[model samples]
Target: MTDFDTGIGDLAERLVTATRTGDHDYVADVLAKLAADDPRTRASALLRDLVDTGAGMIRARTREDNDALYTFDVTTEHDEPVHVDIVPPAPRAALRALAASLNRDAVDRDIHAVLATRGTPDEVVTVLVQCLLWTLELRDTRTPAVRLNCF
Candidate 1:
């Protein structure tokens, strides 16, 4: 695999472990590294900007067919409002699989409501990693929309 791919895989693993174990510092460190390594992508840039701001909000909405839409809103240093939406492929299925792999409880609850209610750090990071992985997959596919920053 390419170095970028390897880096992402490693970071994803680390983020999962950290999130599961409630290691917020480790999660933050991993996110910083990811942002530094891939500053151009929306996910990475958003990570960097959010870290810089030290405050942001995430909203989740469930779509049809077990899909999900995650919206991240943050204000930049210039007071510019930025909103990013990350819709992972079959998010409910993906999150269920993730929970299984992590040996966590079944995701029977409404994930959107959980997130909107300021869910646990674990929930937040889990969704963030999913979105990051989706973005990386999109990058690998060289999708025209991703290439054109149309996502």
Candidate 2:
């Protein structure tokens, strides 16, 4: 994995642990780090609201045929549930090659095309973080499927 992937994975793990333990300060810290960019800023805002409202149960599942597509479910204190499906960009190697070979506009267009089937920025990011966490958990446990009951 690239440094970017490693960083995101670490952040995903930390966010999961913090949320599970009800560590609001740590969650805020993670959200602050994630809010550095535009889309992530919006995503972090949504996560902050959800965490504050005690909606920390994040579950992720990958399709049997396609590991690239992930489904996430989160339920709030009031029992309001939010679901999102996210298909992350191309593989890191492919994306890196595209970035190196193409212009900024072309790279943007390609990425946009890959992400066109998503939901809001917040939902996408939220689901992505959960998905990353699930992958890491799967790796550690060697399980066929993992359910993150880390509320």
Give the residue spans of candidate 1 off by over 4 A: 1-6, 41-151
Per-residue lDDT for 1-151 in model 2, tens only?
5323454445555666666667867665545444444444344333322322221221222233422323334444565673322223322212222232222234543343234213454435444344334434444453444334322
**lDDT, model 2, position 131:** 35
When summed lDDT is taken over every stretch of 10 residues in candidate 2, the lowest stretch is 51-60
Cα deviation at 60, candidate 2, in Å, is 19
Flag regions of model 2 displaced more than 4 Å.
Answer: 1-10, 32-36, 39-121, 136-151
- Identify the candidate with maximal TM-score: 2
Structural RMSD, model 2: 12.1
Q: Name the candidate that leads on lDDT.
A: 2
Candidate 1: Cα lDDT at 131: 46
What is the Å distance of residue 110 in model 2 from its true position? Answer: 10
